[model samples]
Target: MRRHRHAKIVATVGPASSTPDQLRALFLAGVDTFRLNFSHGVQADHAKVHAAIRDLEKEVGRPIGILQDLQGPKIRIGTLQGGRLDLQAGETVRFVLEGADGDKQAIPLHHPEIFDAVVPGQELLIDDGRVRVRVTGPERTSITAEVITGGPISNRKGVNLPGTLLDLSPLTEKDRADLAFGLDLGVDWVALSFVQKPSDVIEARGIIGDRAGIMSKIEKPQALDRIDDIIRLSDAVMVARGDLGVEIPHEDVPARQKELIRACRLAVKPVVVATQMLDSMVNAPAPTRAEASDVATAIYDGADAVMLSAESATGRYPVEAVAMMDRIIRSVEGHKLYHSIIAASEPGEEETPPHAVATATADLAEAVRAAAIVAYTASGTTAARVARKRPAAAILALTPNVATSRRLSLLWGAHSVLTEDVDSYEEMTTKARHHAQDEGFAKPNDIIVVTAGIPFHSAGNTNNIRLMQI
Candidate 1:
């Protein structure tokens, strides 16, 4: 298949379209990737859907990416004492770690660490702000709250504290197990939800061990605060606007989305804009005009992908949603500024540690009319940097880590190849040239651009470049 100017499309699989026929139809409708949300289904269901996708790929003779999303740490209040409780606006309610075991007057707050981080007067929004509480006391297991808005409190309601930094870690035991499962399943990508720090990416990578690519979901405000570090550590990123909209001010989401997409583009990592693009299509056969504009805006902003959550996953018009997204992307891409935006948004040559050297190498590639640019990156940084320029020739990214390889597949105008470790710059260049030739990416007498560092596999150690003939 010919490469697309933008990155790709990731469609979630859900009840409305889980059958083999519907999956195949969606694929034909132009979904480049499929996301299996582990939060909703069991392993068996996912496995079946996976098998069907593989079957469809074989039938069509094209590779399709699969992303398995792990359900990260979800903090919420446990059951209410009485099936439901109504709190008045002026009432001071107590939220405790250990409350009445029965089901009537009290509600149980599960995460004690959250209690530690919350300070006086912090706003805690529950059920997407349908209910609001202002923290008032002691800041311990036993804390006092004044009901900002009265609503019925039920079992397992989600809690969001916008201003307070929760002491709890992003990943829980369940997330670790889910990561392992995704790895074992041989998924192309694993999306880490609620990622708040670089350490979370590192921990997930350690467990995944290169089996699958890691895409950090930027949903929480804390995650946005540390975005640069998280982007550097992760293979790719997902603009999960669902929880993100809930966690931050609604008016800020559009600006934040643009900022995130721009940052990822500059970093040369694939970024997917997700959630509510075609929300109206969840029940209706067609999307709202505003939603269409939203999808087009993401495309024009140079996002690597635009994702559909409930639209293609559980909507009544699953196929239609996929088709509409494909049409919208194509229409947006027709604009001349679309390509220019992508180029102008790329990071400058000065951004890389080995910028001067890599740029010199790239210039040599152009001067000699090289067949491709070969980038040997340990953390995939150099490869991404090369891709940002949108070179005339294909960019070949060779990585020892399979996760990085798969992740790069989503980047624009870049192809990824997994390889054994290379100990030296010379070995890396040689292997890269050989791989380019063997893979039919380059021919004899063709020049190839190669970029790498002296101490291979060291993060941020890139400092060497070369131009060689195949």
Candidate 2:
């Protein structure tokens, strides 16, 4: 199942699309990766869905990527009196650090981290920014704030603290348990939510080790301050515009999304533009024109992938959403300006031999109009490096590790296949030609570019290049 477009699609599996038949339809509809969101489902539910995806993968004869998204700490207000509260603008409300029910005069904020970190002037956004309060007084055990945007709020509504850095771990107890379970189940990637800084990525990596790739989701304004460091530490990045838009200005989300995509491309890491790409499609058979443009805009910005959250997870038209997203990507990539835009945004190469070789592979592939660029990658780094260039030729990634093949499914322009290790130079060329033809990337007499490292099977040492006629 070779995808026609360069960018990949990640669809979340949920109640609407958990069955084997549903998953198989999604995969056939151009969903390159499946996201198992731990935020809503129980472990048993996720296990059954995971098993179905694996079964579908074997049936389709393709390595499909499974991303386990760990729900991070949930910061919310405690129970309220009457289970609800309505306030007007310019009114003062006191939020106390207690578990007792609160009336209109006082609201209970359960998390101690907020009390410790919040200061005067910091805004507390409740229920996804529906009700905003500016902290006017920060006492030892309570905070008094003036309502800037007033609305109805109920028990356990989520709280977003803009411009406040809480000294809290990104991973809660539940996330740790969920991470272990997903790792044991052989997830290819783990998308960590509630990331504030690079340390969060480092912390997740400590537990993950080499078992799975760690994807840092940029959801807080704090993450933007040190985005470079976070991108460097992460194997992939996600522009989680939902929570991020709530924390920052809505107009700023687009700029942040573009910046994140460019940063990820510079780092040679896969980046997925997620959330609300096809929200209207969740109920309707087709997406709004604005939503279609949003997905296309991400493609034009050189994002590695665009994701579907509720649109595929709980949407009524899961298959249609995937097909629509696939069509949008193909249309954008086929646009005449697509190539020039990607080339113009290409980051400067690092001053290293491996990087230089990767750049040359792309350059030669385009110069000779080769059928494909075949990369032998044991750790998938070689494929990522070549993909960063966004070459015209398709990327045929050959790896001895099935995990590498599965992970490469998220990368742009990478058609990963499982293959045996090459012990000699001739063996490498023969395998490249055979796989290129076998994968429909090349035919007899068609030219192809091959890249690998000397003393084969060495990871991260992409030092050789060869041009071959298949």
Candidate 3:
């Protein structure tokens, strides 16, 4: 079934919603994609979910996207003696290379790479920024830091280095293994976590090599600096804010989110605003006011998709979370301001025929109050170009390649459908128009804008546009 809203929803599959019934409920609740978080589940676990999803796809006759999120070099604290330690603000604590029984004064940090790069003035955030530390001394393989924001730091809590760029590869051994499994499963997208540079994208792209789309998870500060290059190399980008909020100041997260979204929009690449969108809904049936607004803000900013992590993975209300986010996105897109905001991000082009035709199709559709902008694409380029214009009408993309149709789901305002390959513009036009009518995008005598590449079945050959009455 087609989603009423333009923005897509990506829901993570986990213990809370891994069954056939649960997964079907999520898909029916408007989840356009299913994320298999490799950090927690094994290949076998995901294989079941993947099979179930394919089964649902067959039942519904819709192309569903699957994203495999690879966990990168994630560092965590060593086991504490009591499993918990309270650090007071301004207290000096020592983190050494050797794992040890940790107390209020000392903790174990076996990752020497962190100590190698940390200096006397840099800050370290422990336990997701709950306990912040300012490095006061660096002696050999140990670091002495005074707590800046103290709290109860639990065993194996994550560490975030805001300023120091650590010497680490984006892909870890575990991530490589996970990537192989996901590619073998034929997942549509593979998201590399903790990306720090463009070379990371190069490395992942090298391994992926057209097997799947590479999505760089932008969470670190270094990734922010090399964002344009990373976006250029990546098939898509994910604004992963869990660890990002830990490194960057909380007050800066909103602005940073907007900046990244804007960059991806200009690049014509799909970006997903992820992490804790409806986190409170993980337990409560209803989302918090701020959380609901947070999701709407992303949609307003023209994010291609808004994601749900724990809210759908281990949450008690997975279906409710998806339905809630779908409602919020639909509501926001219906607002008058949402139209202006997304339209304002229209891309500037060098004025080629394909670009000219794509723009004209959007403009013509709006001028005629057409049912939708129907795009017949092979590589999804023409549809992407049209979607970047953010037309008032829906973007209905018809593709013969199922993979292209699946990947096109990530693009904002592009609702992809799979159909048989056609030969001529007339055939493409007839197919697109009929499909729009069948999909309820138009009725008899209704007008719709149709655009396609001149060389049928060829990539990036869009040069023709026409208005057809259904």
Candidate 4:
């Protein structure tokens, strides 16, 4: 299916929208990518959803992307006395590394990395910042903190350390198991959560190895310190504002999101602005004005995609959420200021032949008022480079590899089609014209821009550009 908008939509699959029929409805409603959240379901559940997505893709005659989001290490307080405790502000609380059922004197924190990394004066947020405490004393086995913002905290409540840099790998035992399962299932993309360092992406890449695109979720504040390095190592990135907003100041999240999106665009990698966009749609039939603005803001900032988490997964109006997101993107992209804003924010081109050719292709396409920019990509790099320009023309990404086409689903303005490889220059023109008209991107008299490598099938060698009539 061809979408009118450039920015893609990623909708998560959950109990509310797992049925094959429901998935088909969602797809028709405008979901480009389907996310299978490993945090809430078993492998069997995900396998069923994956199968349904593949089935829907076949029925719709389009490439659909499946993203496997691995739940990383979860650090939380252990079991507590009577399963809960209430502490008042100005009271000192002790958190110990080893405890069965803790009382007000000492609360159980099973993760030792927290104790080892935390220092005095660093803030510790519990239960999504409902309860805040500052470290007054940090010892080998226990940490004493004074409650700054007091509230009732129950067992296994999450903890966020904004200042402490813990020596913990983002991938836990469960994440490793999930990763292996997802890879074996032939997922198109794998999203790594709680990425704090570039080494985490490197560690995951050692296993993925060109099988799927590795997306680093920028949720931890520490990640922002070395974000350039992490983005360089990753195939894509997600601006996860859920935990990121909790770790850093709420006022800084918007700026960080803009910066992250800009950085990814500059690096020519796909970036998704995720978490709580259109959150009200989870129960209501329509999104709030603020939520609509939030989604539109990402589009105006030139994000490759905007995502729906709970709004599409376990929400009362999953299909409606997708449809609403589609409407918002289309409206924002059609705005008069959209062209100038995106063009002004566009990153400078890299000094390389592939980049230079891709730039020229976009310039020529826009100058000629071409109906489409057809990119014959073996590894999808050519399309990605062209999409980095965010041209007004539609990107018709043609590839022989099904996996590459599937990965392109997350890219901006890309309408991927699985096609046979072209061996000669004449074959390229024929196929380009055929697909352009077949996909409704161009009419018989419409002009289109074609770009490919010189050797025809060689990957990442995008040095050729042509202007052809459809």
| Per-model TM-score versus the true fold | 0.80, 0.98, 0.96, 0.98
User: Could you tell which candidate, 1 or 3, scores higher by TM-score?
Assistant: 3
lDDT of 1 by residue, 1-470 (tens): 43433456789999987899999998888777889998888888988998898788678755667899988887788877665777778788877778556333246787887877888888888887888888888455677888999888778888888856666556688777776677777889889988877888888887776677789999889888889999988878999998889888899999999999888866667888999999999999898899999999887777778898999888889999989888887777777676667556655556545655656666677678888888887666776666556555677777787556656656655666768879966677779879889767789888887887778767545677777877
For residues 1-470, could you state the per-residue lDDT of candidate 4 as single tens digits? 69999999999999889999999999999999999999888999999999989989999999999999998887899889899999899999999888644897789998889988888899999998999999999999999999999999999899999956888888889999999999989999999999999999999999889999999999998899999999999999999999999999999999999999999988999999999999999999999899999999999999999999999999999999999999999999999999999999998778999999999999999999999999999998999999999999999999999999999999999999999999999999999999999999999789999999989778999999999986
RMSD versus native structure for model 3: 1.6
lDDT of 2 by residue, 14-90 (tens): 99999999999999999999999999989999999999999998999999999999989879888888899998999
Cα lDDT, model 3, residue 437: 89
**What is the Cα-based lDDT of residue 85 in candidate 2?**
94
Model 3: per-residue lDDT, tens digit, 407-470? Answer: 9878888989999989976788789878998888999999998898877868988788888898
Off by over 4 Å in 3: 103-106, 350-352
RMSD of each: 4.9, 1.1, 1.6, 1.0
Cα miss at 190, model 4 (Å)? 0.6
Q: Which stretches of candidate 4 lie over 4 Å from their true place?
A: none
